[model samples]
Structure formats: C-alpha cells, structure tokens
Target chain A: MKHIKVFKTTMIASVVMSGLSVSSASQAANWLMLQGTEPAAAAGRAKVWGFIQAQYQKDQSDAGPTPSGEGYIPPKLIGPNLNSQQQFNVNRARLGVRGIGMPLDSRVNYFLLAEFGNNGITAPGGGDAHLTDASITINTDATRIRAGLFKIPGPEETLQAIHVFDYINFSEVSNQLMLERFPQSVDTFQGATDTPDASMGQYSRALGAVRDVGVQLFDSFQSADWDHSYAVMLGNGNGLNFGDNDDNLDTYLYWSSEMQFGGKGPRAEGLKLFAWNHSGKRTNAYNKTQEQDRKRSGVGVKYLQKPFRATFEYMQGDGMIFQGQHRPTMVFNDEEADGYYVDFGYYIPNTNWELDLRIDSYTRGENFIHPVNATLNSAASDESTFDKTTIGAQYHINKKTRINMEYSDRSFESDTATVNAQLEGVGARMAVQLTHIF
Target chain B: MKKFLMIMACLLSFSIQASPDSKPFAEKRIVLQISDPDPFKQTLVLNVANNLINHYGQDKVDIEIVAFGPGLRLLFRENANVDRIDGLTNSGVQFSACENTIKGMTKQLGHAPQLNPSAVHVSAGVVRIIDLVGEGYQLIKP
Candidate 1:
C-alpha cells in the first residue's frame, strides 16, 4: 500500500532522529554516551557519537538435480541472490556533531560529522538510512582540506577502513572491480520519487542515498614514522542524483599514501600503501539518445601484527559506457578491466578481544572496456571471464557486542552465449550482530 | 612559612588544570562545517572533535573544519569510505573542498561522495556560511 506508507515515513524519520540525539523523558538520572572496551585516542574535543548493529542469515540454492545442462552457464548475476535461512538484519543508527573549530584561523584545528544506517531485511526505507556524511576538517603546517560528502575516488579495495575488512567479499571477479567505487539510485528511505523502485546495492547506497554528495581536496606530508597523501575531486555530476540536468556530470578523483612499516602499537603496526583514480561522463539527455563513459584505476597494500592481518589489492577499469542513443541493441566495449585481492586474519591475541580470519580472490575479462571509447561488446552469451572466492568471520562479545560470519564460492569462465546465460551455484551466507555505543 | 608553602603549591596546580567544567567565560570560539558521507559519521565527528580539541586548546581555542558535502571522506584518496583519509589526515584535521566538487567529466549515474583537491577551495557552500558568520565563527554542525 504505497510501500507501506513509505515504511511509515521512514520510521517516523528514524524516531525523530533518535529523539534528536537523546535528552528527553525527564526521569532516569542519565548522561549517556557509553560503550567502550577499547579504541581510545580522544586525542584532542567536540564529541557526540553513537552505534547499534544487528544481524542473522543463512542461504543455499541450486534448484535440485546435478548438472542439468553442463555449461548451463550460471555465474555473475551482480544482483539478487538470497533467502535460505531468513531473519536477515543489519543496522547502524547514529547522530553527530563533532568538535574543535576555527575556520582557517586561530593557528588551526577542525572537524565535523553526521550519519545513519539500516539497509537489509526485506528492504525498504527500514533499510532506510540517510545523511551518509557532513564534514569539516583542516590541519596546518603541511596543508589539508576535506569538504563534505566525500570518498568515491576509485576503488582501491574500497580504501579499507571498515574497522579494516579484508575478506567476506572477494571473487565474482573481485566484486566486478570493487563495484566501481560506490554510486547508485533508489532504495529510498521510502520517500520522494519521480522514479525509483529498487536498485541500490551491487555497488553502493540503499534506501535514501546520496552517499558522498561532493567536494574534496587533500594534502598530507609527514616524516618520523612516514606518511604521504594526495587527492582531488569535483563532484555532483549526478552520482547521488539531484537532477535538473545541466550538462550532466559526476566527478571524483583520488590519490593515496600510507606508511608505518613497524613501530606504533599493538605489536608494531606493520605495513601500508594505496593509490587510485576514476572518471565519469553523461551530461544532459532525457529524450533518450544518451551517452556514457567511465574510467577507474587502483593499487593497495596493508598488514598488521599481533593476530596477523594482511591485505593486497589491484584494480583497473576504463571507459565503461551504456545507452548509445537508446539501446542500439545494447552495446558493450570501451575496453579495459582489471581487479585483484588477497587477505589474511587471525585473532586469539585477546585482551578485550575480537577475532576474525579471512580469504579472497579476484579476476576479470568479459568484454572488458576502454579502447578510446565507443562501441561495446560482451553477451554473445557474455564472452567468458570472471572469478571469485570468499570466507570470513568476526567475533567480539564485549564492548558493545558482535558476531559475524560468511562463506562464499563462485566461478565462471564463459563464452558460447555466456555458458548459456550464467548463474553457476555454491552460495551460503550468515550474520549475527548486536552493538551499542553512544 | 616557606613563602606560604609555595603559594599552596601554586593553588594545587591551578585547580588541577581547570578540572572538568570550570570556565567562567573566556573560551568560546568555533568554526566547523563539513559535508556528509558516513563512516560511522566519520567516527562520530572524530569523537566530538576530540572533546572540542580538549575543551579549547590548539592555542587557547580556535579550530577549523570545512569540507564540502559528502563530507569529503575525510579528504578522499581512494576512500570508498574506507581509509577515512588516512584515519583523520595526520591528526590536526583541517580541510576544505568544493569547486562544485570537481568541474565536470560525466559518467556518474550515482553514489557521489569522494572529493579531493589537495586542500582549500572555499568557493561555495553558501559562500562559506556567510563567511563564517562574518568571521566571528561559533557555528557548529557536523
């Protein structure tokens, strides 16, 4: 019924943004913002944070019978594949307002933030989370500037940082080159639409997106433990759809740097390195006859001590376009696609412990693109080439609860009508999480 | 009396360095404006800008946080909301972006966030919030 009244108006705007960040219903001597077993470094001040997570899942599918047509070709769908052990849930509820301020004056100091999440379980605005980020930051004596809603500078294993995720996703030909570094439409928190029913993940964004609006620029230069950084961006070519078309554009650019080889904390922090670049184009077109193009590049590296966590990544993709003035028989071929991955993890080195182990692999070649653009190909049943493999786990019972797990195995080497139109089987997924922090 | 016990040990180390909430007045100057993206709200806005930079210190209170929308992934450099711009760009945290993001080059389709300009480009965002409330700053929003 109108998508359940747009999921009751995005769950009443997330219970009025968690009651405007607490402080209500007078009664219960409180001043909450608690939950921390460790992850300290309050370092310097302006604080208001939060957290919450929940999950459950299990799956399997192959439609009975073994080998119902060899080359029955089945693999790389990039969308839809779930429902085997239902009760799937994932959450991240938040509110923000950081500290320290002086707008390029008073010698320098700065920060600002905001967030909200929930994108799973029967989906629709209840998987509704909005306002991905709102920023403000500055550092002097070496230079820096990081505007708002940023970070989509071309997949280098997605720039690592999900508390540092190495596996749980890999193979599917390395997630189609890390799903072209975030950007999607629809999954509305169940509100506002001229067009949008579904299609958010398989890349990024879900239920109310605009993940990283636009604006970014960077600079970092450090020695005495080693650190280097470089960046670039010029967003809003409609990557988060705000439409009203005016030369239609979506821009983002990036360059990375990391170094700390050994000598920080937690058994000597190990190693790091990263690099990236990405490009896009589509500009103005509604009466059909629209044009498109893209480019992506990559590099990655990381390592940690103690429980041994490792990572490696490589990426390459160029000029990926679609719609030549209205499906001229659906084209494919701009040429150039590359991807790679590696992972390692173990944690018995507990103290306030959290543990994880991992594995991943990637590959490419299925009508790849980037040949100075124009003319596409792949689907003479999908011209063969794709790969995948994954295994993962995470456990932290205290300090705000957590328990996660995953297992995946996929393979495809098509051609001949894409082995009869892909979807080879061997999939299983699971989850369990409960988190709290304020 | 040994100079009154060294002035009562310098008034007990200046009342233990102004413990908790004891700032009668002098200490209120802010300048923060970021754009969003969500990495746990960029670590909950860097844990409230590390307690307002330790309740005002980075030189007797003065800070700056100006990033463009999508909150520039803490200064994106391959950031898919991952490196958090190297976990908060070397501590001192200060950045600025927005040249309408990056002029134009097409092929977006969607998921915008991720801008980097090497730093500083205050050409918009409502003219830098009316020039930081007319250079008096004190506006705070993450």
Candidate 2:
C-alpha cells in the first residue's frame, strides 16, 4: 500500500512538473485525475476508479446430494437453511479498479472501467475479484461511440457489474446464459453431490462469472419531449475475463429505448425497454455429445415515474453440463436451463434511502439428468426448479458509495432424489459493497 | 432522395414557426427541455427525442431542448452523428452550454468539452433556465 502511494505521488509530480512550464491550454489539455482521488489521473481527461466489497452468506438448510449440486430435498426448488449447524457458508471480500484517460482536443475522450474477483472471475486462489469492465468513449453532444470491454444485456442481470445484485449469488437462469456465465452458481458443476469436490473448490468464485467484453458502438437520439439510445457488441463467448480457450467468439446486442409518458412536471416521466442477446457456446463436454448449436437470450423493461423505478428481465442459456460422475463437460439430453427476475424500487425524490424488492427463479437442466443421496431417490420433475425472493433497502452515503440490507426467502422442489442439491435452499445474504463510477 | 428531400422540407418549415411572428401555441401542446451533466440522463434525453420525433413528426410540433452546465457533453463535437446536431439544431433544437460551468468544469475534467459555436453559451444554469422559460420553453428535468 505504501509503495503504491509513493508511486502515485511520484508519477503525479513528474507530470505536474512537466505541465508547470506549459501554458494553461496544455495544462488544461493534459487531462489528469482530480489529484486527490485514489484512482489517480489528469483533469480534462476522464478519471479512473475502482472499489472493494466484503460480504457473507449462509444457507439455513443442510445440503444433501441431488441433481443441482447439494442439499436435502426441500418441499420446493428453493428454501431456507433446514439445519443451522450443518448449513453451508459463503463469504466474500473483493476489490477492483477503473481507468479513464485525459481528454484531448475537440473531444472529452476517455475510458470507463471496473474489475474484481481476481483478474479473472473464475481464476484460482478464491479471491472474489475480476476485471469487470473497461471501455473507451468518444463523446459529442447526446451522441457518442464507445468501444472496448463493454456491457451487452440479454437479461436484467448486470453483465459488467455482477456483484452489485442484492442477492449474494445469481439466479439459475442467469448462470446458464451464453457461455455458461458462473457455472458454479447453477449447481456444484459436479453432478456427483451437494458437497463440492474439495480439490477444485478454490477455482470458482462461488458466485461465478460475468459475460461482457468485446467492442461495442453506442449512440443516442433526442428531442425536447423524450430520448433514446442503443449499443451493439462482438465479444468472447465466455463473458469478460474468461480468456480464450478453444471456445468460439460470439456477438452480443443491447438496446435501451424509452419515452416521457404523460409528463408535465418539474421531473421527467418515462418508461423504457432494454433488451440484450449473446451467442451461446457449448463446452467440450456438450460438443462431443450433441451437434446442436445453443445460444443465450435476455429481455428487460424499466419504468420510472418520479420516485419509483421498476425493472424486470428474463435471461437464459440453452445448453450446459455441470460437473458429474462423467466429466465436467459431459452433455446430457435436454440439458439446458434458464431463469427470470423482477425487481422494483422506490426512493423519495430528494432522499438517499430506497425501498427495493426482487424475485428470482431458475432451474438446473441436469437436475433432471441425475440424482444425489446414495439411497432414497426423487423424480426428475421434482428436482428441476429453484427460486428466491429478496426485499431490501439501500442508503446512499454519497454518489460514489452505498450500503444495502435485505431479507431473503427461498425454496426448491425435486423429484428424482430425496433432497435436491444447490438450487433448492433458504438462506440469507448479508453484504456490504462500495461502488464508484468515473 | 425523395425521403431526404421531404425531411429537408419539413426542417425548413419548422424553423419558420419558432420565429416570434409565428408562435406555435395555436395548438394545445407544450415544449420541454433537459440539461444535466449526467451520462445516463443524457442518454435518456435522446430517447425522449426519438419518441417525440416518431409521434409528433419533426415538422408538426414545436420542440426545443436547452443544455448547459456539465451538460455540454451530450453534443460532443466528434460524436459520429456530429451532423445530427445540425439536423436537430437547424430544426429548432436549441442547444445551450453553460459558460461558467464550461470554464471550471472543463478544468476538472482535464479539457474543455467539444462544442460548436452554434450552441448558445449561457452564463449560468439558473439564468439559462430563466431565459428559456421566458422564451416559453417548457421546463422538464429528466
């Protein structure tokens, strides 16, 4: 930490000295960060930023082996921890950074970014960190073109900011989306049991991966009464930071359009439609077994009427294979899964407090392919569903940070095994995260 | 060419209406304006424009948006549709940049925002609002 501070000061001094002799034009022209900020940079140029979040989660129920991954068969696909003493544990402390460059002439040109869950979301060493998003933009009026590791939406899920969701983990449907973002979130990946294969547990961020990275072009259309914007991207099939394996590259599309509905006020009134899509890829396991091409898709809607904002989205991946007695890549017939979520929040017009609620539901495709529990069995119909609900509030300390608290209620139902695995469980996600936008 | 010619005709006719001699208030309607330093809000404003363009036709209605403060960005000079500014501006899309905010805000951001001289430079956010309202621009903060 001390070394970084010294390094920052030195770099600034060199630039400041160089800038000292130059005219205000050059000084103003040479963008540097607002010197006092942590994400060091120049003025006139966009700034860079990053953050760290610490969180904890507990499953109120004891997990048994099942199609999804772990836990005893609950009456539903998602439910509370059944036995506190044997409950599973989830904890996270993560950090990331953002880099915006100094502006040049005629343009307030700069980069926008974020990263956490280790350089890679699924990288080894188990630190929940990742290079979330990094993109550059050339601005002009209400229109601009952005390129770099950017966001592509198919679902309401945050493609570049996955960890911000109120729930500690993503829904099942979100996990299956294009390139199987964060496979661990669906089930143990190991069809074998509710308990993870201790050897590889260190590799995956129990929360999983984010699928946004690629070059995108964006622009806006505006009028006195309303405004609209759109973005399109081409990226790695395996979400951001997943790196290239043999997996093929894919294309993504995102469009957010809206209008001022019945408005005659001091505030703008409107409703919007935001949708996104990605090319899905099959793992080596599924490819060897099935020749079918699978894909991921998502749609979301947002409406803002003064102090109220409501958003709902559904996203899904066509084919995936979790870990199993076979191999981690083995594909089974009809093995595809997806999920949906609806979230709404209200904040007093001029206050920092917001009331929020979200409902998420999903199914593990393979939950129908096999069963857990060495003895008693359940039917496939009984094991495929999983879902959860969360109602919460957030207090914004300021523009760059906020603290959130929520109550989570969940349940799951399985057929083939006595106890369903990961998808069905009741739990609480207690977390605190810091965020900043540059 | 026909569509282009038609759009051109519509643009020319609309400009004539903003003239004080030809007030557009003969119809029961209103105009709105947005000016914010926010990127999200700027994007939203554009969408609103699209909605108005589609529903009201660029020619039939009187619409104008005045931007200032850090808001000068919405119309970055090099934006791909740099020409869109002219298309909107010529058709009565009044753009205003805050001279005071521009002086200090640009210093903070590192450089001055790319702006066309054609954009009106107001001395302050408050004054800009008052001036536009005085000109009968409906006030809307989206």
Q: Which numbered prediction scores highest in TM-score against the true structure?
A: 2
Could you give candidate 2's per-residue lDDT for residues A295-363 as a string of tens digits? Answer: 667777766675787777777666553422222333333355667888788886688888888888876
DockQ category of candidate 1:
incorrect
Model 2 regions more than 4 Å off = A1-43, A64-102, A105-130, A137-147, A159-172, A175-208, A241-243, A260-269, A283-292, A321-334, A348-351, A367-383, A418-438, B1-115, B118-142
Tell me the tens digit of each residue's lDDT in model 1 across A1-438. 554555566467545433322211111100010110011111224456656555454444333233432211112111222212344444455565454342112122333333455442113324344554455545333444555553455543444323223333334433454333322232111111111222322323231132345555655444444555556666654433333234544555555444455443222354656666666654223223555565666677766665677767776665442211112122233545565657666766645444444344433334423223333324422444444445666666654445556665545444433122323443444444455555
- TM-scores, all models, native as reference: 0.25, 0.56
TM-score, model 2 to reference:
0.56
Compute fnat per model.
0.00, 0.00
Question: Each prediction's Cα lDDT score?
Answer: 0.42, 0.48
lDDT of 2 by residue, B107-135 (tens): 87676764553455667756867765777
Model 1 chain B poorest 10 in a row by lDDT: B102-111
